[model samples]
Target chain A: MNFSDIEILFVEDSMDDATLTIRALKKGGLANKLHHVKDGAEALDFLYCKGVYTGRSINDHLKVILLDLKMPKVSGMEVLEKVKSDPLFKSIPVVILTSSKEDPDIKRCYELGANSYIVKPVDSDNFFQAIKDLSFYWMISNQPPHHL
Target chain B: MKRILENFIPFLFVMLSAFLIAVFFLVLSNIKTLDETKNLVEETYTIINLNEDVLIDVISIESSIRGFLLVDSDSFLKPYENSIKNIESKLLLLKMVTEDRDTDGKADELQRLIILRIADTKNSIINHKQNNLTIEQKIKITLEGKKLSDKIKNVIQEINSRQLALLAQRKHDNIDSDTNLKLIVGVLILVILFLILVGFAILKIQQQKNKLTDELKKSNNLFSTLFEHNPACISLVRISDHKIIKVNNSFVDLLGYSSADEIIGKSENDLNLIVETSDVEAIAKLIQENQIVKNYEMQVRTKNGTLIWTSASIIMMEVENIPCVVSVSMDINAIKKSEEKLLAVNRELEAFSYSVSHDLRAPLRAIGGYATILIEDYKDVIDADGNGFLKSMLQSSKTMGNLIDDLLAFSRLGRSEMVVSEIDMNSLVKTVVFEQLKNDAEKIDIQILNLPSAIGQPTLIKQVWVNLISNAVKYSQHKPNQKIEISSFQKNGQTVYFIKDNGVGFDMQYYNKLFGVFQRLHSKEEFEGTGIGLAIVQKVISRHNGTVWAESKINEGSTFYFSLPKIKIKTK
Candidate 1:
C-alpha cells in the first residue's frame, strides 16, 4: 500500500473497537484509503513518518484523523495536540471516536481542537451507522481546505 | 491599695480638722496673752501718771506753807488747806491704781510720805500764826521739811522708773507673741492649702473609681450574657489541671446535665465526654503548637453515655490571668448522619456506573457486533434456527447495552456539577422540536406558543425538552392525526412550561410508576421504549429545582408540566 494514498489515520487501543470501526469504514467503501494504528504511538509514528513508518510521506494530505482517548505509551489527546499545534498539519480535520461519553473528555477534545466528537454506541448497528455517516461526511461531503 | 486610700481619706479629713482646731485654739490663747500684755502696759502708764500727781501735790502743800509764813495772810492758809485735801485724794487714787499687785509697796510708802509732809506744813503754819517763833527755830523747821519732801520725791521717782521698765518688757513680750502668732498662721495656711489639694486629688480618684466600677460591671454583664446564651457549647478548661473551670448553659444542656454544677470542675475525661483518647492527645498537641483547631469534627459521649457528633473549635486564652482553653462545639448529629448516608450512596452509585460504562458496555458491544458479523459474513453456515439464536443474542446485548447507557446517563445527572443560567425557553423548545420532528413535520401538527425565559442549566434543560418531546411524539405515532402543543404560563412565582399531546396515554393509576427508571407502561410490542425517557425528563426537571407531573387518560392524551423558578428570568 502506498503511505501517501492513506486518507484516514484511525488510532484506537481496543482491537475489537478498531475492527468494528474499520469494518464499518470498509462497508462504506472508504477502507482502501484508510489506515489503522493499534495505539497512539503508532499513529504518531505514521504521522511523523518515523520508525517502521519511515517510508511514509509527510506531504500527503489526509481527509480525517479518528482518535481514541485512552491508549498505551501515548494518548490520542497528545496526538491531537501535536497535529493541531503544528502549522504543517493544523488544517487537517480530527475526529474523536471513542467509547467514553464522559463530558470532560468531550469538552477537552473540543478544547484541543477536535473537529468532531462522537461516542461509539454500544449497539453494533448504531455504531456502524455512526461510523459510516462520519466517514462519509469527513471524506466526501465535507470540503478539504486543500481543494478550497 | 486604692481601697486602703479610699478608707483613709475620711480619717485624714478628721485629723486635718483636729489639727486646724488645735491651731485655732493656740491662736486664741495667743490673742488672749496679747490682750493681757496690752492691759498691763496701759496700767503701768496710768500708775506712773498717778505717782507724778502725788509728787506734784506734796510740792503744792510745802509751797503753800511757805507762803503763809511769809505773807502772814489768811488767803495763803486757804490755799494750804486746799493742797492738803487734794494731796489726800491723789494719794487714794494712786493706791487704787496699784491695787492688783503692790510690786514694791512704793505706792503706799509714797502716800505715807506725802501725809507726813502735809503735817509738817501744818505745824509750820501754826507756829507762824501764833508769832512764837525765833529766827533760829524757823530755819530748823524749814530744813526738816525739805528733807522729808526729798524722801517723798525719791519714792515717787523709784516707782515711776520701775513702771517704765515693766512697760518696756511688756512691749517686747507683745512683739514676740505677734511674731509667734504670724508663724503659726502661716503654717496653718500652708496646711489648709495642702489639705485642699489632697481633697481634690481624692475626689478625682473617687470619680475615676466610680467610672471604672461601672465599666467593669457592664463588661461583666456582657460577658455572662454571651457566655451563657451562646448557641455553641463553650467551656473553659484550666491548662495546668485540665479541670473545667466554667461551662455555659449550652454546654450544660449539650452534656445532658441538669445544672452547670454537675459539669464544672470536672475534666473531659472524667465526664467521659471525649470518646477517643487520640482526639484528646491530638488536641493537646495542637494546643502545644499554639494552633487554633477549627471545626474539628469528633465524637463525644454525653452524660447519658450516648455518642454524638460535634464540630469543635479550641483556642488557648487567658481568663483572669489563668491560662485556659476555650472550646466551642456545635452539635452536628443531623448533618453527620445525612452526610454519611449521602456519601455511601454516592460512592456505591459511582462504582456501579463506572463499571457499567467501562466494563459491561464493551463486552456487550463485542457480543452484539460479533453476532452481526457472523450473520453477515457466514449467512449460509448459520441455519435458520441458528440465525434466530444469533439474532436474539444480538437483540439482548443491544438491550443490555442500552440499559447500561441510560443508567450511566441517569447516574451522571446526579454526579455532574450543574452550571445554571438563563434559558430562552422559546428558542430552546423550537430547536428541540425541529430536531425531534424534522422528518415527521408532514404528518405531525405541532403548535408552539411564546415561552418565557427561565433559569436552569442549559444542557440539562435541553435534555428535559428532548426527553419530553420525544416521548410525546413516540406515544402519539399510531394516531392518524398527531398534535403536540407547547406553551407556558406564570403561576405562584414559577414559570410553568408544559407539553400537551394527543397520544395513547396510560392510566392515571400507573402515574406513580411513570417516572421511575426502566418502568414501561406499554408492552414493548405496542410502543418501543427503554422506559428511561420520562424518567430522564423528571430527573432533569427536578434537578433544576422544578416540578414535573403529567395529566393523562387511557387512549386519549397526556400533558406534561414542569415549573422553574422565575427569580433569574431577567438575568443575561
Candidate 2:
C-alpha cells in the first residue's frame, strides 16, 4: 500500500501473469520493492487508505502502477479516473495492461489520464520481453511527484 | 353502308307462296276426273228379259191376274183379260229389246207376233173352261208359245249381239278418249300427291328456317351486347394492316376515344398508343411463340397524348372468323420508382461502415505511441509508487495498441483474399511451433504426431496452426515435461488436425466465445493475448472451407481440432 516503499504495484487478476511480470521486472533490474494486488478494488483500497489498507498514508508517492484494464469490482478505468482527478495522487503514472487493442477503450483510457498503454503478447518470450520493457521504462525511468 | 342493307334477305315469304300455289292446283284436278269414270262403268253392266227389270214389270201384272183367275165367284175373269193384255204388252216390250240387226229394224213386227201368240194361248186356256189346264194341252200350248217365242228370241239375240258388237267396237274406237281420261286422272293424282308432299316438306322447312332465324337473332344480340358492355376494351382489327376494324364502347371509354366509328379501320400506329419501341416486336414474338401475355406492363399514350404506364396483356382470337388481338391494361408506375430509391440506400450503408473505421483508428496509434515514450524516457525521475503508476499507464497504452491492432486484423480478415495452394503442413506447423520454442532458452519436448500435407492458402492456414500450436506451447511451459502433440487424420472427406497440450485448460462454457475477436476467458496477467488468435484461426479455416473447435477442462490440458475439406479449396 505504501507507494514510496514499493517500486512496482502490479494490479492484476491472474497469478501466472503476475509471476511472469515480476520475473521480467527482476530480469530487467527494475524490480525494487515490487508489490502486487489481485484486482482494481484492492489496488484502490491500497491507494486511498480504505479497508485492509486503512493504516497506510493517503498520499504516498509512487513511480508506476502496472494496471490490468479488465478486473473485478472497480475497473482500471475507474481507478485511473480516481487517481487522475485527485491532486494528491495525480502525478503517479498508471499504465494499462490488456490483451485487446480495441480503439474506443484506448481513447477512453488516455482521456482518463492514463500515462501509457501496453498489450500483453501471446508469444511467451515476447510476453516476457513486454513485461521487462514495461517495468524498465515505467518504473526505472518515469518520474513521480513529491509526497502530498 | 349501302352493302349492309343489300345483304339482308326476307327468305320466309318467297318460300311460303311457292308452296301454297302448287298445292291448290293439285287438289282441284283430282276431284273432277274420279267422279265421271265411276258413273260410266255402272251403266255398262245392265241385263235383259229374265233380267231384274223385266221381272219387276211381270210382278206388277200378277196382282191383277190373281183377281181375274177368281172370276167364277164374281167377275175375276174380267181382270184376267186385262192381265193377258198387260202380259202381252210386256212380252212385246221384251221382244223389242232385240240383239239381231234385222230384228232391231223389225222390232214392231216381232212385238205384234209375240202379242198375237200370247192372246192365242190365253183363248185356248179360257175355252177349256178350267182353273188348271190339262198337262198335254198345257205342254202343247207352252210348246207352241216357246216355239214362237224362240223364233223371236233368236231374232232378239241377233239384235243383242249386234248391239253388244257395236258397243264393244265403240269401246275399241274410244281408246283415244280412254287414254286422254287416264292422262287427266294420273295428272290429278300426281298433282294431289305432289301437293301433299309439298305441304309437309314446306312445314318442316319452315320449322328449320325458324330455328336458324332464331339462332341468327341470338348471335346478333350477343354480339351487340358484348360490344356495348364488355369490361375489357374490344376492337376489331383488320388482319391486312392491323387497322381497327371496329371498336366497342369499352375501347372508346377506356382509351378516351370520341366514338367507335372514329377508331374503326385505323391502324394502332395511327392511335399512337404504344409506349415501347419494341411493342410491335414483342407482339410479333408472342405470336411466333403462341404465348398469351396475361398481365404484362407497358406504357401507352392516351387520346389526349398523356403518357400512361399500364400493365397490358393480350389475347388473340377469331371475330367473325378473322384474327385479331384483345388487350386488357392496368396502371403500375409507383413501384418502379421505389425500387430505384432502395438501391441508393444500400450504397450509403456500405460507405458509412468504411468511413467510420478509417476515421477512428488514426488517433489511437498517436495516443499509444506517446504514452510509451513518456514511460520509457522519464522513468528515472519517478519514485517507486510513481514508477509503478507510470509502468501501468504504459501497459495500458500498449494494450490499447493491441486492441486497435486486433480489431483491424479482425476486419481485415473479413475481406482478405485467400489463395489456396499445396501446403506442406507438417513442415508448416513444425516451423511455426519451433520458432516459438526457439525463443525459450529451456529445451522442451514437443512430439509432432502424424502431420499432413494438404491444399490451402499457406499464409492464412499457417497462421491457424501457428496460433493453435503456439498457444499450446505457451500454456504448458510450466509443466515438468512440457509437451505438445500435433496430428491429423481424414474424416468424411475432410482433414481434421489436432493439437494436444498438457497445460492449464479452460472451462467449456467460456470456450463458446473463445474464437470471437475480443472474447477472452483468461485474465491478462495470466495468458497474454488480444483474444484475436482463435478468431483468426476460425477465419482462416472457414476461408479454406473448414471448421475449428476445442475440448478442455480446468487443470487438465486442451485439444484443438481444426478440419479442412479435401475438395479443391479455393481460398477466396
Candidate 3:
C-alpha cells in the first residue's frame, strides 16, 4: 500500500472503541486509505514517520486526525500539543472523539487548536451515526488548507 | 481626688462663714465698748458742772451773810435767803450726780459745809435784829461762816478733781476702744476679701466639675447608644471572675432574654449560656495569650434552652482600666443550615453524575452494541421475530442514551461555572434556529423579530434558545403552516425573548409539569423527546436569574417566554 494515499488518522487505545469506529467509518464509505494507531506515542510515530513507521513516506499528509483523551501511555493532549506545535502538521484538522463529554479536556483540546469535538454516544446506532457524520463533515465537506 | 475636693469645699465654706460670724461679733463688741466710753465721758462732764455750781452757791451765801451783818438791811437778808435755798438744791444735785461711792463721800462733806454756813448766817442775823448781839458776837459768827465756806471750797475742789481724773481715764479708754475697733474692722475687711476670693475659687472649681460631669454624661450617652443599637451581639466579660459586666440589647435578644439586665452581672456558666464550657475556656486561653479569636464557630444556648450556632470574634480589651473580653457574635444558624443543605445536595449530585456517566452508560452501550452486532453478524440465522425484537431493543437503548445525555447536560448546567458576556439575542436566536433547521426536512416558518441584547452566559443562553426553538418546531410540525415566531421586548427592566408556535398544544391543567425534568405532556408516539429539554431550558434561564414561562391553549398555540436582564453599558 502507498502511505501517500492515507487520508484519515485514527488514534485510540481501546480495541472495542476502535473496532466500532472503524466499522462505522467503513459503513459510511470512509474507511478507505485510513491509518490507525493504538496510543499517542504510536500516533506520533505515525505522524512523524518515525520508529516502526520509518518505512512510510514523510511527504504523505493525513486529511484529518481523530484523537481520544484517555489512553494507556502518552495521553492525547500531549499528542495534540506535539502535532499542533509543529509547522508541518499544524494546519491539519484535529477532531476529538471521546466517550466523555464532561471531561474538561474538551476545552483544552479546542484551545490547543482542535477543529471539532464530538462525544461518543452510549448507543451503538447513535455512535455509528455520530462517527459517520463526523467523517463526512471533516473529510468530505470541510475544505483543507492548500499547504496540507 | 475629685470626691475629696467635693467634700472639702462645703467644709471650707462652713468654716469661712463661722469666721465671718466671729468677726461680726468682735466688731459688735468693740462698738459696745466705744458706746460705754461715750456714756461715761458724758456723765463725767455733768458731774463736773454740778460741782462748780455747788461752789458758786456756797460763795454767794457767804457773801450775802456778811453784807447783812455789815449793812443791817432787808436787801442783804433777801440775798442771804436766796443763796441758802439755791445752795441746798445745788448740794442735792451734786449728791445725785456723784452716785459712785468715791464721789459721794465728797458730795456729803460739801452738803454739811453748806448747812453750817447757812446756820451761822441765820444766828448773826437774829442777833442783829433783836439788838441783843454785841459786835464781837457778830464777828464771831462771820468767822465761823468763813471757816465753813473754806471747808466747802476744799470739798468742791476735791469733787471736781475726782471728776477730772475720771474723765481723763474715760478719754484714754475711748481712744483705746476706738483703736481696737479700727483694728478689728480692718481685720474683718481682710477676712471678708479673703472669703470672697475663696468663694470665687470654689465657684470656679464647681464650674469645672460641672463641665467635666457634663462631658462624662455625653460620652456615656454615646457609648450606651453604640452598645444598645449595634446589630451584632456584644458583651464584655471580666477575665478574673468570668462575670458578664455588660451586655448589649442584641446580646439579650440573641439569648432570648427580656432585657440586658437579665444577662448582665451573671457569668456565662452561671446562666448556662454556653453549650460547651470548653469553648469558653479555649476563647479565654486565646485572650489570655493576647491573641484574637476570629470567626470561632460554636453552639450557644438560648434562654429557652434551644441551642443555636454562632460565629464569634473575641479579643481582650481594656475598659475603665480593667481587662475584659469583648465578644462580637453573629447568629449564623440559618447560614449553617443552608450550607449543610447545599453540601448534601452536592453529594447527591456527585453520585448522580457518577452513575449516569459510568454505570448507566456502560450497560446501555453494551445492550445497543451487542444488539447491533447480533443483527448484523447473525442476520441469516436470526428469524424475523428476533430481528424485530433486536431492533426494538436497539431503539430503546438509543432513547435511553439520549435520556442519559440530556440528564448529564442538565446536571452539568448546575456544576459548570458561568462565562458571562454581552449576548446579542437576535444573532444568537437566529444561529440556533438556523442550525436546528439545517437537518430537518420540514419547512419551519421562523419569523425572528427584532430582539434586544442581554447579559448572560452565552453558551448556556444558546442552549436555552436551542431547546425552546426546537421544541417549538417539533411540537408544531403537525400544523399545515408550521409557523414559529421569535421576538423579544424589554419588560420591567428585563429583556423578554419568546417563541410563539402554532402546534398541537397541551391542556393548561398540566402546565405545572411543563418544565419538570423527565415530565412529558405527550406520549412518545406523538412526539419524540427525552422530556429533559425544557427542564434544561428552565435551569439555564434560572441560573441567569431569569424566569421561564409558557402561555398556551390546547390546539390554539403556545408561546414560550424567557426573560433575561438587559445589559447595561457603563459610560465614563
TM-score of each: 0.50, 0.35, 0.50
Q: Residues A18-137, candidate 3, lDDT per residue (tens digit)?
A: 777888888888788678889999999998889988888866777899987777689899999998999988878898976667756788998998988777676776688788778778
Query: Candidate 3 chain A, which ten residues in sequence have the lowest lDDT sum?
Result: A139-148
Q: Identify the runs in model 1 with alpha carbons over 4 angstroms from their true place.
A: A1-9, A28-37, A40-65, A72-74, A78-94, A100-103, A113-118, A123-148, B1-223, B227-355, B384-392, B424-427, B439-452, B480-491, B567-572
Candidate 3 regions exceeding 4 Å error are A1-16, A24-67, A70-95, A108-117, A121-148, B1-355, B358-398, B417-505, B537-552, B556-572
Chain A TM-score from candidate 3: 0.92
Among all windows of 10 consecutive residues in model 2 chain B, the one with the lowest summed lDDT is B1-10
What digit string (tens of lDDT, one per residue) describes model 2 on residues B6-98?
232234336445645654554454444444434323322332342233333233333333343333233544554565566555554455334
Error (Å) of candidate 2 at residue B436 is: 25
- For model 3, the docking class works out as acceptable
> Once model 3 is optimally superposed onto the true structure by TM-score, how far is the C-alpha of residue B157 displaced, in angstroms?
20
Q: Tell me the interface RMSD of every candidate, in Å.
A: 1.8, 10.5, 2.3
The CAPRI quality class of candidate 1 comes to acceptable
Name the 10 consecutive residues with the lowest summed lDDT in model 1 chain B.
Answer: B64-73
Going through the candidates in order, their DockQ values are 0.32, 0.02, 0.31
What is model 1's DockQ versus the real complex?
0.32
**lDDT: which is higher, 1 or 3?**
1
Residues B1-572, candidate 3, lDDT per residue (tens digit)? 65776688788778877877887888788778778777777777787787777677777777887787777776876766776777677767767767664674777777777776777777777768888467787788788888888888888788888877877887787788778778878877887787787678778888998999999999999988998999889999998898999988988998899987887788988889889888978887876686799999999999999998999999888899888988999999999999889989987887667556755765677677878989999978999999999999999988887887788888889988898999888889878887988866357677888998889999999989889888988898888888998897889998888899999888999999999999999999999998999999999999999999999999978999999888899799
Candidate 1 on B1-572: residue-level lDDT in tens? 77787788899889988988888898999989888887887888888877776777777776766666556677867766776777777777777878885549877787778777877777787777687677677777767887898898899889888888877887888889889889998998898898888888888898998999999999999999998999999999998999999999988998899999998888988898888889988987887786689888899898999999999999999989999999999999999999999989998878666656766766777788888898899879989999999998998987887787788888788778889888888899999999999889889999999899888889999999999999899999999999999998998999899998999988998889999999999998898778898888888888888899889988899999999888553456
Winner of 2 and 3 under TM-score: 3
